[model samples]
Target: MTSPSHHAPGAEHLLTRVGEVLKPALTHYLDLHAHPEVSGAEARTADRFGRRLAAAGCELTHEVGGHGVVGVLRNGDGPRVWLRAELDALPMRERTGLPYASRDDAMHACGHDLHLAAAAGAADLLARLSDRWRGTLLVVGQPAEETLTGAGAMLRDGLYERFGRPDVVLAQHAAPMPSGTVAHAADRVPMAAAGAVLDVVLHGRGGHVATPHLAVDPVVTAAAVVTRLQNVVARETAPADQVTLTVGTVRAGTAANVIPDHAVLGIAVRAAGEASLDRALAAVRRIVRAESAAAGAPREPEVTVASRSAALLCDPHTTGSVRRAHTGLLGPARVLSWPGSMATEDFPLFGDAGAAIHGERGIPLVYWMLGVADPDAWHRTTSDGITSDGAASGAPDAAPPPAPNHSPHFAPHIGSALRPAIAALTVAALDRFAVT
Candidate 1:
């Protein structure tokens, strides 16, 4: 639906229009934020999104790939453009004090509130601007991103098969940066690839705390394994190759007197590319089992990978289009060309099969980054609040986003973050579809 314009005409009119159309979408976005559903389980959320898209004139599909939703709008034939919105929320408690903050443990702390809203807004805007261009417009509301299964699930469930693949694949992330600033890096390394969650179980006999010598302490063995796991990255990976092996969680003995019979360690491995990822995973398991055995534990540690993802390789053409779009919409100075993130994104897998399609046919697939950092208001809101643990330590503010995207407190100025994202999505789709 269209709305009135307030600012002066021209670019301001366009901006105002985008915001106006996005108001309801923003409300929906906030509503989704207040009631976030977790990954592999976005049934209700998916239904809500489907209704909205269907109401907005998108041909809707539900449960496409375990709670995934797809909305297709076919305009006069041109180049096909695909816009992706992640529907899953992280398994984090809402810490943002916004009135619309998520009431559930699953919160849109990753700015996905804005992501999905922008997708909705983009769909609405593109529908309105249908006279401009396009072969087809596909708005994808992918689920289960937290577990990195949604995108892969969509492809497996025939995302491309059911709905022909696009000539250009474009998706924008809402940055927490200053208002009106849009940044894009061309053919730069997109998000780094990641491997499955590694669950390691170390088995040993339990004994009394005072008579520790009498029992095979799994805790001690697990501790040794944790300390030595660092060597997988330090000693095994090449010095030049970027690889990270972190044993983030460990569970063992409950009481000081009794040694537990079993020890468990959870790890996440990040690699610059697939080769390094495979190498690191192999080394990590080998070390875990060896360390357990050497620590006098008769049972070997069991290593298992729960999920995996390939690195995000930015399609050169798509990256170039994003760069030009940013340069055109926001200007050169406002466009910060930084390196891509090491974090993982399932988006890259869409083009991985190398199928005969648009992006496969040589259209560049670009993932644009919206700056969500360096701004004072956003920084303070997202990075300043202290956690319950930090509050106990007498600090009330949270630590700055060690990075963006998965932090529970990573909040963005939605009003400011939304405009550029909408404009970028709208402009990118139009630009690509207008090509060829």
Candidate 2:
């Protein structure tokens, strides 16, 4: 059975014409996949995207924020559509072993490479079909998304002021779903959470291991805190609230014989609600400090909020219109309902219309997931009821599960997904200015 194809009343032929040049766009995606750069250091990646946007004949601006690029193409006067793509690679190495796999230590594990290529392709498509719509096209190449600062950096650097505040914002991310499909979550509630990276240091008195009582053992206190934190969500949080806490790292003494003077914990906390996130973070601080004080620590534990990602909420009007536009481009079968995620994204900063953190306001926004998993692998995982992403179990050898974003083995079937991704994004952008 063939998936239904839908497009604007007059865009079908133009979109088909756009397909003729999509091969180069696919090649560009592969090229980006091969040459990955890490966040805050995407000079080479930025250059490539800038070149592409320039080739598409847009008024281009470079380095609004660190390595962030913006391109504006003005038509007549209509709704200004904003599109965005991430340009950073993860620090991890790629193990996909594809022909175009990255040789650099950094890898495009999160599919920012694909996002860049798709955005480039969408720009190309829209540029080619300029006669069909009248408005301005704004495309952004963002940096440092892994650290959750790129969107904020761009905004703070006068993204909306220099360019124009979008009538509607459209962006997409790569997910572990089957190739040739998309997942969308457009609702009043955030599809993803907002939170911060927590850096905590527990101070203690260093002393001989033989005379443990003489030393205020921070390791013991840290351990106890971790144990108690297990019940933070289980006991302290109300059942109605949504919060998840992950203590990703813990470091202490170097030598076995001597007790360490201090212990460090790297925590990631997120929640769908701002109040929930605040409460969770407060609990984290209280737990660590109280544990240290109870252990007779010489100083209070230090807790710092490193980075905060505002929760993601897709504007209902934008989301609904984009969904129908996507359905018109692809079939209903190719577009699936996306389950809300606990993952945090900096993309929220672009659409902080609801005052997510402090007092930040942004344009209306819509973000969806582009499925990238191999069909068979997706089927296997689905059959096995593997609710977790393939790499989440930390069991690479357990089974040949599909590669999730940010995994070493993660690789998008760029060839298969590129055209549809381009079509979907182009349709969504044009939909904002489309006439009935």
The numbered model that scores best in TM-score is: 2
What would the per-residue lDDT of candidate 2 be over residues 190-259, giving only the tens digit for each residue?
7778888998999999989999988888899889988888778999899988899988889999899999
Which regions of candidate 1 are displaced past 4 Å? Answer: 1-13, 207-211, 253-258, 353-363, 373-403
Prediction RMSDs, each to the true structure: 6.4, 4.8
lDDT of 2 at 369: 87
Please report how far candidate 2 places residue 358 from its true position, in Å. Answer: 12
Q: Kindly list the per-residue Cα lDDT of model 1 for residues 364-392, writing each as its tens digit.
A: 56777776443554335444332321111
